[model samples]
Target: MKEIAIAGAGPMGLLLAIRLKQLGYENITLVDARAGTYTRPGILNASIFEELTQLIGLPVDFSDSYHLKDVERSLYKIAESLNIKIMKANFTGFEGKALRVEDEHHDIHILPCDLAIDATGSRRALVNEINRLFPDAFSVQPIADPSHKKHLMAYVKVEEKTDSDPPSTPAPYGFDFMVQKLEELRAMGWKGFVEPGFYALPLAKNKTCFYVEIPENLDASQHEKWLKTVVAFHTGKDNFDYTLLPASRKYGSKPRFLTFIVDPHQVNEAFFQHAQFPCVIPVGDAQIEPDYRIGIGIKSGAYRIKCLLDAMVLEKDQEFHIDFEKYQKELAAAMQMHAAALSKFYQEKQRSYEHYANLLSIYETVIASASMSKQKELQPSFAELIQAYAQSLYDAGNNALESILTSSGDIPLDKHGLIADEKKLEDAIARLIDAYKYAQGDLYTMASLKLNEIAHLYEKLADVFIQRGAYGSSLKCYEKANMIIEKILKDRAESVLIKYKHTQTLHKASRYEDMYDMACQTLSEIKNIGMDPEEKKKFTYKLELNKALALLHILHIRKDLEERDYYEDECNKAIKHVKSSPYLKDKHLLQLTKLLGEIPIESMCNILKDGDKSDLAADKSKRR
Candidate 1:
């Protein structure tokens, strides 16, 4: 039998002791400052947790906030029945083959033990020691991200009038119940938790537990006020509208608050082993804190305990600590993967919130307008419809962005990760185009919403192709993107200026030649488009200057005289327009002309590829 001392008799610590006994370790001891096994207030999914508790021959009803005191009480009885030792003591540290322990009687003693495991929650002493003595083993923030300050959560009991329908696994991926709940809240004028942060469980016949995720930036004092507002609006406290089935917390009791981290996984540091002969380690949250939104903290922690014990059993019943290094490495890798997935999940929630809230607001406005009318329900305003359409377009664009990771196994470390997934990006562009087509036909898209969205989508798609070595496809994508922009901008002169904004975005992504052609075509089109003379001149000068700079860049790439002369021609055009037009005179254009004059272009074109030729002679021959 291996002698092991497990600290902090929380669920993980207690369960670990039980697991060791099953693995044939007889001299196992459980210790905590408080005299009990513990569980915090949380709604466990109960699938795996019950199995862990069952290992100790203890049973949980799985329908209530598990009380640590009661759990510890039960653990003590079980220990008594099995002849396993339970100690009420504060652990100081390890002193070789014994534990430096301070008992409840205020007496300090070094108790003989081979291994000391820390299962103390967030504020565990081992974490403090590691931070104080060996700083590199942990991050600046002990258990969670240093950036995430403790935030408040309120658990005001909503009075159970209709009664909850017993505890059961919620609908699998059951967003409908959540959607219905959100609709009810929206109708009742109470909205906080929804698609992203909202969660509820049918606990018993009396009350349903609701969680409100407050961001870390909020203040503590606002907890009561925020909860009160939820209660007041949910219950219709002012109007007594029982028909609304208004939700309210139990009357007379104030909504209380407790502090917890919103995103715990942001703390990346996993563990450090201080000794070798007799090993000690921190388990569960003391190692990796999970995002509470996933509801897997307890379950994940218990799983770790099982892994630790399993590793020990495989080591031929040697002290469990011997195999923990493997556990730590595996734990770190799993934590990393989980953190990435959680971040994606959180970001999706945030995006959905933004998109849905805008649409919800518009729907509410249309409803309000209808109610105030002396006639039938009014139609949504054109502005509201257009705004909703814009939001939809925005969502479609974001979906494309996400596919860069999802559809393709593209992650940051992979050479073909992020936006470099060409095939996936092409598929995303197709989806966006389909969405645009439907929106155009469905909502009578009267403006440039579909056009601009499709254009930008193709721009991104082009960049992806470039990364995948499909330069021809990239150029085609850019051409389509640029054509749509020009087609949309043709009706208004100011819109031409808007089209120029995309050039830099294209250039920023290394699409210089594409950007150059876009600028040149827009400038030429601006001349034919009906614009105020002064406005046309100003845009013309800007476009001409950009075209000259682009050709100069092209010459650098080709080292060909044809490209250099093209650069000079663009500069001369700007100069001629500045001198001839009465309304146009730009100092920048004259300066550019002077610079162009200084550049000595050789008399003949050389190194210009036959297929790359784009000149007035070629155009006039085609016209003839």
Candidate 2:
């Protein structure tokens, strides 16, 4: 009998041992440093379960998912039943045709084996030793994007409740409607996005897991702090459970950190042949780290083991030799395909975000217009659109929470559970456009009130996107907000709030010229419009402050003495206006004056001397 030693008793290692034993390998030893520890859940597909059942000649209890601990325990039990020796030891290194392992008692022994498999997953114990011994035989390359390498995860258990009736009526317009829908999801323990990199998955009726993708440049120690920051930003009284419990002590799920294998190590035939070691092969994450988001690596590992077992079949009259070449070719092919799929998956994610942003803009515009127009005809269709979008989010989020896919599969990249019917959004936008086109004089202004509301809502959504780290999506939202404001302004609509928002968006977009123009126009309009004494004082102070800030930003891009004097004068007037207002408290006036005074003249002049368009963008980005 040929002796086989498998290092690392993770799901991949244990599964490999169990399969080898079934293939009539009598002497198999499994070595692991962490033999009895389980930190997260294991993902399994129904197809994998089918294959496992056939291999073991026993029914694999099929389930939607299992904890990583359970998967390890089950496989360990099967290994024990098969009388395969398992050592609670660390695989130290290889010593000339044998594996060197340190036992639990710290005694070193050279394990003699005809075949050795490195199933050590990301640790890559045996694989790394081989690379060190024969550096030229393997090529280790880091993935193009390291964004998927680090992850943070935690679990929470919510009490199961009896079925309750959902809301019968649709929610009101603007932010309140979104708040209500989110609250409904929270009550049912539905999983959804908290931030761009942060999301939740429901494990069972009472259990859920929250995951956060760690940023590449962030230090490992600051992971907890970053998670807390994201939670605090998104959490409020109504959606507290959705955001707070994952990182909070009340649920008792302190976040755990996991590192994925970012660098894929490819082994050439020389490593196996030229190393002069007998049949030392790398498998599972030791060979390749499949994308962790889908947990496809485990499935891939299982499939490869089955192929390896088949390749191990001995012919009656032939010398026994493992087909290392075939295995390497298959491994390379699989990794190539996996890499392509992973790239496509991320591209799909970006597209999904864009689709969601588009749908959200259209829905917000339609609903806000319906409110402004007070046309009973628009109300029913607007309500249906709201219901469809909310229901889609609920369904898609729950589906994602329930199962971890083993493949990229058919992820709804274009739709992404934001809206069910593209036609609905298109129809609604068309209707709103028609309403605006048909309105006359005062009615035109009334119809265009939706523009102001939509612009304000888009600005708020953009802020949310910024908090979520979706910088591109946020920029798009800001652009949309500015576009709406432009539409309102073009119609000569009367909304001081929209004009103020226009100036802010232009500043954010780094369009300093447009901002200055809008600010100047708004300041002129404020003079003509009558307002209450306190209200007018507030608008005048804010508008003048924004105007001066815009001019200062413009001066950063170019040296203009006229513009510099104009900004200084504008700042003084704003400071003076804020100070004279009876509505302003002493502290408020002091803070306002300090805000204007703190713009460093020398620094602004230095920037003006050496600034370009890139400098202006950089300055704006820093401010944001």
Candidate 3:
């Protein structure tokens, strides 16, 4: 590559700059237009950061506990040390292979480069403009606006640590204070503007990161003033202090992060041919920014850039082409997975928030009480420890739930795993249930809702389990789901209908007794429900059919002399019921009649064959 120009110097952009330099591309220019801030304010996945750094042959060593700013700043500094020319210019749009950039002095220039990286966050400034100019480049509109807006971001900077020594837990006290304040802000207009609450990440040992809704029509001064008010409100007491970082104001509206993808067909062809768009590849939020709720923006950007870099390196021997097409498709799929997970993760967060807060509240209460106690050593009961432990699990589960999704929406496994992910879901369900036990009142209600969701998830997991031939685990999942669903639906018609399905499943597995028992119970439940008489009668008839089918299965299983009598009697009874029924389907009645008639002829043949053998025996004896 003769010359490559990259737009934006966030973590992804910075990393791509470093990668290009490592690969020894002669002329490379890295540009950071958005106020030249080293990083966007968000959580960074430190694990992947390490891998990417290693891939680029960069020596950045630290624990996997860095924030967005740390990564971007480090990458930017590394790029500079490698003699990569960095520019602070705003990218207005593109002029063919030439990039149009506006400098700080407001002077515009068309700088030509072989390739350009669009790491311009969610704005996708050049991507949008390029598509407008080249309508045939993509299949459809690439940007997706979220209908249900929950894109509230907050930045929490701690003034000082309680002590110089770092805390043992990854969770910072600032985050705890942030959460508790969110709990209080529900009385304010915070809930109206945000999700149930804000999620917090520590930028440093002393600094925590959060996001919020910036009120409408606020000027720069007013915005800063408002942010200060919010900071004070959250850190007024309990030794928590913070400073709100300025919100990212693009256009007039504070849009939730928009999701984008190049058209699938075009993206798939990016590697083989020198497509026009690869020269202007979009990475990070510019490509597809998932909801803050899903929280994959940082990782998503890193993955896209890494894939591009690898593709370039692999094919470096032959030519200058990169696997941009495959990179875009995989990246798009990853983004969609996050979007799919948003609804479920958001709901779980809402339902489980109370218990999460209560646990924290209880912890503070215990600590405070212990400090005031006369005994030097004070300890909580076994029950209290269990309660806290369970609560912690639920909190972790809620966060992890975002990873479980499949293309067909049937299977649920972690998105990042090489194989089916069971433990993530299993641990979540187990811990949630454990926490649900001690829940009371509002906590109890929320837990019930969450349990219902877990039940649904379990049903999906059971399908995957059965497909994998883990029938024992499948059955256990089914039982758990059935139990939770039954309690939720009670004696309602829906429950009866679900029970009918259970009977069908049992029949499929040849569990005849279980099928018959379930069918009878469902039949009785239908009769007891106060649904319309016609509705009840219809459901009851279906259950009777299921019961008869189970009986036929039972007869087939038996080898005794009584098998025939029992089979005949059950068939006759079922046949009679079919004829008497008002709404019995015609096909079912005809099948029953045909089966009933065959039984008699089969029985006669059995008896006559035995008599013939006996007569032959008698004749032989006389001869002897």
Q: Write the per-residue lDDT of candidate 3 for residues 1-624, one digit (tens) a residue.
A: 456777887767777777767776656787766534544444656665667666667766443456555676677668778888877887887776778898888889777876777777666666666667875453323333332343345555656545432222123335334444444443343322122332356655555655434433344355444444344443344444556544446533322232222111112112211345337777766665555545466666666676677666423432365665666666667656545555455454443544545545654564454445411332333243345445555566655654554555334544542225667666665656655766545555666677676676667666666677666566666776777666555555556655766676676677888887888778767767777788787777777777776765566465463657866565446545654679777666544433333332343223223434354445445557
In candidate 1, what are the lDDT values of residues 275-372, reduced to their tens digit?
A: 53234567766656666656566667766666566556424545444555676676666666555655665555543424544545545554554445
How many residue pairs clash in each candidate at the backbone level?
2, 1, 5
Ranking by TM-score: 1, 2, 3
- Report the alpha-carbon TM-score of model 1 versus the true structure: 0.56
Residue 214 lDDT in candidate 3: 41
How many backbone clashes can be found in candidate 2?
Answer: 1
Candidate 3 accuracy as TM-score: 0.46
Output the lDDT of residue 97, model 2: 74
Clashing pairs in 3: 153-211, 153-212, 154-210, 154-211, 154-212
- What lDDT does model 1 reach? 0.53
Error of 2 at 237 (Å): 6.9
Q: Once model 2 is optimally superposed onto the true structure by TM-score, how far is the C-alpha of residue 58 displaced, in angstroms?
A: 2.4
* 1-624: candidate 2 lDDT, tens digit per residue: 267789999878888888877766667889886775544453444465566667677655534555556567667777777788988888998776778999878999888776888888877777677778878455655443633455666554533342421111222334444433433333333233222245555665655565665555666676555554434333322223432244434323323334333444434332365445756777777766665565567676776676677667554432345766676566666667666766666644432323343445654564565555544544544444343444333333333422322143211113342222334433333333334544445545644664454456556656665566555555566566666555554434345765676566666667777777877887787776666656666777677656656665555556755656666566556545544555545455433333333444543332221323244445556777
Give the Cα RMSD of candidate 2: 21.3
Question: At residue 190, what lDDT does model 1 achieve?
Answer: 37
